[model samples]
Target: MHGSAASVGPAAADTPSRGTLDELDLALVNALQMAPRAPWAQLARPLGVDAATLSRRWARLRASGEAWITCHAAPSQVAHGALALIEVSCVPQAREALADRLARHPQAMSVELVAGSCDLLLTVATATKSSMTAYVLALGRDEAVTATRTHLVQHLYQDGSEWRMDSLSRDQRRDLAEAEDSAARTAAAILAPEDRALMFALAQDGRRSIASIAAELDRPESTVRRLLHSLLHGGRAVLRVDTAHVHSGWRSSATIWMSVPPAQLVSAGDELSRLRSTRMAASVSSEANLLSVVWLHTLDDLARYEAQAAARITSVRVLNRAVNLRWIKRMGRLLADDGRSTGFVPIDLWAPVA
Candidate 1:
């Protein structure tokens, strides 16, 4: 499964620094990223660690909020709605409160306090264009929000679900991919309301046991298991383990907007998604429609990566770029000031607006 992590509140003064992740810890995280719910035995052999050791390490990581796994509506589900990236310029003093307010909204998938032209950036999903427009208009009326710009996503080539920790060996990744393919082909069913409820529960904790979900939903264990299988294999839901970028050797992230011919859009998006630095790649409704976010070891790496990308994807022209200074919330999870996950708020992207 694959989902994004969230953030909330400022980091405590004693918050641990990013340098704490050791080599083994990084490898374990990469393994989980490849297969979020892979059995401990399945993951242990490749990492050269015992199953028990893997489990204990993972438990520690989850408890410390340095890492976590959660489920999200798959790309297919997100495509059923109107998805947009909103740039908000808010009054300096009200930025924090405004972020908190936006973070609580079910439609706001991500709320970040960023640098550059806008003070905040939000990725929102609404059921329709009209609803999306209404949300934007409402934001424009907020006294704290001085201005806003919305870019509707036309196509998402690569989202958080596609990002991987490249720490694993080629053979290891190949092995994991085969297992995932096997699981993916096991079921194909349309999602129902109860399935959505299961999704919400999984979103809160991807590692939640089958028994727990069954108990909470008041359903038979076998039924819940079957539904979970359908949701996973049918691609209705995905699970992702999120961690601080700093811990992954990526200290900075930049959003790049590109302009490409309509004919080359898909090819260009595909090429961008193949890049190691890309976190997200999509075609949006704007002059610069090809939007991508890339991680870098430092701000200086942005120019180098951009030049390389421009050369490789000759059909796409670079338009503009912005840096994300701090992420206030990501994927419905509240983050601490230092980018560690502190809590979660289940993303109800399709929740009705009244």
Candidate 2:
């Protein structure tokens, strides 16, 4: 189904509610967006609310489509090759259908409809230059996709804080190049098809041992170990992580869209990267000229960070803040191009008591 093109904003008091969000709702939503694994107790603590209350609020938010919580592996991590940001210019009338189609495609990492020169922004991953060309050609086949332009991700300048902790304090942020030089180099070779198949199998059940992966792929254990070493070294992929969140206490989270002046983007973003609560920050494709999205751990932190970033950077606009209410999908394995499931497990949350 097509999502509404309407931008989010508060309306008149007397008007019937299209959708109304409360402060607590925003805080809870933001918290879950960052760590869907956080327990009810931890989520409740910061708000001075009980776990039961947090659970009740979560249920209501999910019922409304205000947010989605899903664990998604970076596209290149699961596949090999390049990741690109593609902007689509479409007839306003056809926007809905275009968005819906793109949303269902397996290759889509994320999609957003915006107001500006382009209507849609898509994050796509492909294995080779030829595949990238084929992908663009495929878009041309769709009537709704009128015109498209793309930017290859020279590097993932920033991946949002959703999946990884990007916003670590000065002492907490470690230099990747220094920490894993050999692993990074080896990961390039280990990301082959056989290796992916092995990973795909392990992804389903992390408890599976090297022997198990070897048996499944009909490869020797030594070979599997070698492949895994390469993957770890290359930073191509990571083993599954056991994640938890704050039902034990109070916490909040937010996704902030910022418009930065072109000249100040690098310096400004680097400064933001040092904050304690920022889990992730990335430059993304937007219909608006907005340059970045930052994830925060709490509403208070979000407010403070925005004020600080705004003060330091004069070149852009912080256009929209979407307080993600709840995440519907956690980690789940996606289907490979061959139609086999990747064995990704969604972080399962225990149902809150009534």
Candidate 3:
């Protein structure tokens, strides 16, 4: 509790196994998803585990790089920023190296090697529209790729925060939910100096205790607590547990683009967000107005998901499917080929284009 996640990326590992997360591990993950910063004592009762045991399990998982919790700027926190998805067609010989190079960019929220029409798909955000333009122009100038296409996100209907592991019982989930203070929820937030510092601190480890954070900042515990609660409950930031995708049994992810009638765009986005597999759902600027990313057990799962989507939204038409082969950098964390956490690059959403 006194240390930072600088040691292990949001630390949860396979359930004392070599291959995959076990039922207990998944339950823990689900618990964190519902209340990422809950105290061990608070979370343990719902899982029927002792606080000491729960802490030990999380340590093992974090040490193994199987799973961990991290935070990122929430929509209200980045009301002034620009976000977009860019698909790149790369030269076969240079694609691998280029993906790694791009993954290191502070502005790149995610960079994935993909199949289908694109070699790489980048999710980028910038402080301003001009910076995004600069980023696009620089991307086009890079000699590693043949062409690039960009999709600007217009409306964010859903994000990773809403994705949860269905390993907990309804009573367990309700117990966790009841612990939250509803009065803390805020529709908007503006960052102050302390807020930025707190945000950066949480970006490193969302589960850091108030006492630990206050110690790190050399500030009064009450001050740090106030800022932390405001940042989280006020919608200035989001904290979520993330797992190494490949090892988590969700072996692959895909980017799907669909055209929806203007009248139905909002409903379509809502419908897509309901799919358990959906990682992100948004309204975007392109021939296909609705863009979605989904996690899957196998590549074949997309077909069934597509059928489900079609049935859910009558007028939607899928224009393209890009299979994400590997998450080179998911959110702000770097990943190995097997999807283990290698390190992190704290996402600087407003960083200038380099």
Candidate 4:
């Protein structure tokens, strides 16, 4: 499924004030993480907060860009296509400019300035193999890019959509999970032209009022409402919140490559997905069959995790890893120098490369 986009803006004059998340804030975030479109009253009942208070707090979070929800095409829609993690080596001085340019491109789902073998890392999506080849060729020809390496994703085990803050009580989580399970029972259908338009609108803001979307599409409100409900509940689209990791106290992130026995791949991936640190995990078409993006409270945790993973998951072997030095763009939201989300560039995963 899809998420938020990066926006371009001037750097902040000072670091945005860091506000700590109290217990209620964490619970609210965890609840929304489970069901991004859950009505405030439903959320409030479990959290023991009034619907009005919950609504007000959510507004504040969105306004501050600390957290907000957006929509993306479901995995079934994208699995037939190509997704690649691109390692870009560019002129040191041109890194920022190049990252900004890639962040603005509709196909780039994420771009990061990193301390690895490459200067920038990009997660790119394209609808077909030819399009993917063309996009990679275009990047290779760019004057600023000196070299590039791309690893095609084969099987995604756990995407960011499955990552959670784990701040809710077990009973609270069970209730939310039940609601989601019920909604997911509907069968998914192919997207029509109008459905695509609605998805584009929601990609900008998952919580956008149905009336506004109907007006934009020039369709009756009832029609728009029905289409949206079908898309979400039918598993045609994924709605998720993109939050600032700094605010959530997750200050470090890493990308890992691993080798796994073919017979053990599924079991290993399933086990890795359950770890609290995993943000994204998948099998790729390379010497390394498994790749994972993990979040940590500190840089030191990476070594500890690698050691523990090797010791515990005997079927999987760690091959290589890189820490994300800075995020140029996450989901679709561009990060300012201070790491606050400034603007959005909608992720159009199925669009042809220009």
Q: Candidate 3, residue 112: CA error in Å?
A: 0.4
Cand. 4 TM to true fold: 0.91
Off by over 4 Å in 4: 1-16, 175-190
* Global lDDT scores for all candidate models: 0.79, 0.49, 0.81, 0.78
For candidate 2, write residues 17-109 as lDDT tens digits: 224456676565555543343567665655568989987876544333233233223434423455566767888899867865665554554
Write down the lDDT that model 3 would get: 0.81
Per-candidate clashes come to: 15, 45, 8, 10
lDDT per residue, candidate 3, 1-354, as tens digits?
Answer: 211113343334443435788888888888888877778899889999999988988877777777777777776544566899999998899998999889878888899988877899999987778898999999999999799999998888888876888888989988899664322323555566677678777775678888888887999999998888777778777886898887778987899999989999999999999999999999999998998899999989999999999999989999998998788888787776777776777787666677
TM-score pick, better of 2 and 3: 3
Give the alpha carbon lDDT tens digit for every residue of 1-354 in model 4. 233344433234443445656678778888888877778888887788899999988776666667777777666555657889989999999998999888878889889988877888899877677888999999999999999988999877778876788788888887777544223523436556676788889885787898898888899999998888888778777787767787778888989989989988887888788777988878888888888899999999998877767776887788777788888888777775545677887787667676
Cα RMSDs of all predictions?
3.5, 12.3, 3.4, 3.1
Q: Which regions of candidate 2 are displaced past 4 Å?
A: 1-80, 87-104, 111-121, 144-151, 157-190, 203-207, 240-265, 276-280, 283-290, 296-305, 312-354
lDDT of 4 at 138: 93
Best-first order by lDDT = 3, 1, 4, 2
lDDT of 4: 0.78
Model 2 is weakest, by summed lDDT over 10 consecutive residues, at 1-10
Which residue pairs come into collision in candidate 4?
A: 2-72, 4-332, 5-332, 5-333, 6-332, 6-333, 6-334, 7-334, 7-343, 7-344
Candidate 3 has which clashing residue pairs, if any?
10-68, 10-69, 11-62, 11-68, 12-61, 12-62, 12-67, 13-61
In candidate 2, position 133 carries an lDDT of 69
Query: Candidate 2 local accuracy as lDDT?
Result: 0.49
RMSD of 2: 12.3
TM-score to native of every candidate shown: 0.91, 0.50, 0.92, 0.91
